[model samples]
Target: MADEDLDIRMFVDGKGPPDIDPYFTEIEGAEAIAQSVALRCYTPKGYAPGHNIDAPNDGVFLPDFVQSTMTPHSLFTAKTLVHGEARKVDGVDSARVSVTGDQAAQRMTISVEGEGVDGEFEFSLTVDPSGLGVTST
Candidate 1:
């Protein structure tokens, strides 16, 4: 297996008890990278312990657009931040990011495309006051 980890869905959805067989299922390769990228984009810099020394301030920096209006400049900045973090994943070779928002909904969508060791993958995440949600695309 090429980099394996416990399936995060088991924890995220609070699916039943942990003793079940499915709870311990592992995700590998591109799937693993996709999950990693989603987490990297969601985590704030300095929040994760033992972070990269060179880029101490890694991860997406979501601007406070709740109090203010969302602008093109802010969207562009978000895309850049997400792209930078996505590219830093160990198995990722390249990454592209797109950011769009709905001012009225107070939500932002971030889409990412990347080539990983196993293959190419795409996924999108939504950020709102409630929380962040990820979906594979």
Candidate 2:
């Protein structure tokens, strides 16, 4: 349900100082998913989203990836692990990534089908002061 997407209000809206874990986790998950998708679609040569010569033109990220688990949160990042291959075989595959989760956990299911690759990618993760990392598929 859309309610599960990312409830920033849960932590905001006069609720409290705002538990940034949810927002941070959601952002990390999104970045990871995009990276995974890019890896699936194919990233450009010397194309990196960084700051240094390799780092892209992105500004200072909310998470400077200081304690960032896998070289600054990514597909391989401990907080987000996207498994299962869903390639667009005929290049017409109706690929869809549906996300669902709560403050406790977040899950992403990627479905792709066209001609070449057909499968489902399920990524489950949880990031919080209580815990962090991909729990399951």
Best by lDDT: 1
**TM-score of decoy 1:** 0.75
Cand. 1 Cα-lDDT: 0.65
Candidate 1 structure quality by residue, lDDT tens digits, 26-55? 666665566666666556665541244455
Model-by-model lDDT, in order? 0.65, 0.28
Off by over 4 Å in 2: 1-53, 57-95, 98-118
Q: Model 1 residue 107 lDDT?
A: 86
Give stretches of model 1 more than 4 Å off: 3-22, 49-55, 61-68
Q: Write the per-residue lDDT of candidate 2 for residues 24-79, one digit (tens) a residue.
A: 43432332333333332222223332212452321222121222332322423322
Candidate 2, residue 87: Cα displacement in angstroms equals 9.9
| Model 2: lDDT of residue 27 | 30
